[model samples]
Target: MKKTRKLIYLLEDNDDIREIIAFLLTEQNYDVCAYPTVKSFNEDIVLGKPDMFVLDVMLTDGNGIDVCDSLKSNQKTHHIPILMMSANTQMFTVKEKCDAEDFISKPFDIDDFVKRIHHYMD
Candidate 1:
C-alpha cells in the first residue's frame, strides 16, 4: 500500500511570503495548510493535526512564540515538530525560550529553508 502524504501547517501573516513558501513545499510533494493568524489556525486544529508546524515569530494578533509554546505544552500536539521563522535578530532569545525543534531567520535562502525542513522531517 502507498503511504499517505504528510501534512504541514504554516502560520504566516504575510500573503506573498506564505504563497511562495506554500508553493515551494507543494513542489516538494508535501501538503500545506496556510494560516494568516493564530485565530485562523486555532479554528483548523480540530479538523486535523498536521505532521509538522511552520510558524512565524510575529503576527498581527500577537507573537508566534506564544502559539508555539501552547502547542508544545498541549498533550496532543507537543510531539509535532515546529519550525519557526523570524525577522527579528533577537529571535534567538525567543527561540531559546520556546524550545522549538528548529528556527530560521527571515530573508532566508529558499534552499536553506527546504534543507532545514527536510532535516527535521528526517
Candidate 2:
C-alpha cells in the first residue's frame, strides 16, 4: 500500500506568500491545497477535511479568527490543528480568541515555520 501524504489547507491572500508557502510545504513532502482568500477555503472545506490548516489572520473577504472559530465549533473539523499567521503584534490575543493550535508571525523564519507545522502534525 502506498502511504498517503498529509493534506494541508492554506488560506493566504498575498500571492507571493501563498506561492512560497506552497513550495516550501511541497518540498517538505506534504500535500498543500492553497487558496487566495477565505471564500475559496470555504468552498473547498465541504469537499473534504484537510489534516491541518494554516490560516492568515487578515483575509480579503473575512478574518481568519472567525474561520478558526467556526472550524473549532464544528464537530467534523474541530480536532484539526490550526496555525494562525499574522503580522500583528497582538497575535497571541487573537490566538486566544480562536481555536488555533499555534501561530506564526509574518516575516517569519522559513525554518521555524516548517518546524511549527511539524509540531502540529506530530
Candidate 3:
C-alpha cells in the first residue's frame, strides 16, 4: 500500500524562508501549505487543518505566539503539534507564552530542524 503524505501548514512572513521551508518539507515527502501572513493562514485554515503547524514568532500582521495559543486552545486544532520558530524572541519566552510541541531559534541547524519535524511527524 502507498503511504499517505502528511500535511503541514507553515506560517512565515519572509518570502525566501517560506519558500525554503516549503521546499525542505516537500523534499521530505510532506505536503506543505505555506502562508505569508496571519490573514492568509486564517483564510486557509478554515478549509481544513493540517497534521502539524509550523509558525513564526513574529509576523507583520500578527504574533505567532498568539496564533499558537489560539490553536492550542481550540478544540478543532489543539491536538496538532506546533513548532514555533523565531529569530527575534527567546525560545524560553516562546515556550512560556504558548504550548508549542517544540521550539527552534532562527538560524537553526538544518539537521536539528528536520529532526524536530520528524519527531512530530514520525
Rank by lDDT (best first) = 3, 2, 1
Off by over 4 Å in 1: none
lDDT of each: 0.90, 0.93, 0.94
Against the hidden reference, what TM-scores do the models get? 0.95, 0.96, 0.97
lDDT over C-alpha atoms for residue 77 of model 3: 98
Tens digits of per-residue lDDT, candidate 2, 1-122, equal 99889999999999999999999999988999999988899999999869999999999899999999999999999999999999996876996899789988898999999999998876
Q: List candidate 2 stretches off by more than 4 Å.
A: none
Off by over 4 Å in 3: none
Q: In model 1, how large is the Cα lDDT of residue 54? A: 95
lDDT by residue for model 1 (4-98), tens: 77899999999999999999999988999999988999999879879999999989887789999999999999999999999987766977879
Error of 2 at 57 (Å): 0.3
Worst 10 residues of 1 by lDDT: 88-97
For model 3, residues 2-110, the per-residue Cα lDDT tens digits are 9889999999999999999999999999999999999999999989769999999999999999999999999999999999999964788789999999999898898
